[model samples]
Target: MYVIHLRYTGALAEIDDALEAHRLYLGRQFDAGAFIIAGPKVPRDGGIILAASMDRDRLDAIIAEDPFSQQRLAHYDIIEFKATRLAPDLNLPQSPWL
Candidate 1:
């Protein structure tokens, strides 16, 4: 699993300009089952993406397609974790094993 943390580095206008494109990119990833969840941060400074079922290389490549990344509007921190547990009601594309 991966937790993609994005921090805005550019102006708000720029981020707003690319928001649609970024959302579209995310939509594509969702369709492909790469992203489990995504949304803006509460402070509106950036965003978070919960991703699964992919290797680092591939995930990085896919992330590069985000408008924020391509236009240098944000920086990404991709964290990998071995998920050992999940709420019983939650289901994800990747297997969360012990």
Candidate 2:
């Protein structure tokens, strides 16, 4: 599993300008099964994304295409980890986590 954290580095105006394009990119990634969940942080300074792991290089390249990234409006922190627990309601395979 992987978690992507984004911290805005540019002005709010700039971030807003790219929000739509960023959402579109997110939609595409969701459709392609690259992402599981994503949302803004509580303080709204940045955002978080939960996703399936792919080749690190590919993941980096894919993220680099985000409007925020393209405009140099944010910094991305990608963290990869092995999950060892999940709730039954999630209905996901336990093999990887276990």
**Which model scores highest in TM-score?**
1
Query: Model 2 RMSD to the real structure?
Result: 3.2
Error of 1 at 89 (Å): 1.6
lDDT of each residue in 1-98, candidate 1, tens digit only = 88999999998999999999999999998888888999999899999999885667888898889889999999998889978999999876753321
Candidate 2 Cα misplacement greater than 4 A, ranges: 92-98
Number of the top lDDT candidate = 1
Question: What does candidate 2 score on TM?
Answer: 0.90
Error of 1 at 16 (Å): 0.4
Q: Write model 2 residue lDDT over 1-98, tens digit each, in one string.
A: 68999999998899999999999999987777777789999998999998776777877877988999999999999999877888878854322222
For candidate 1, what is the TM-score? 0.92
Alpha-carbon shift of residue 44 in model 2 (angstroms):
0.9
lDDT of 1 at 56: 78
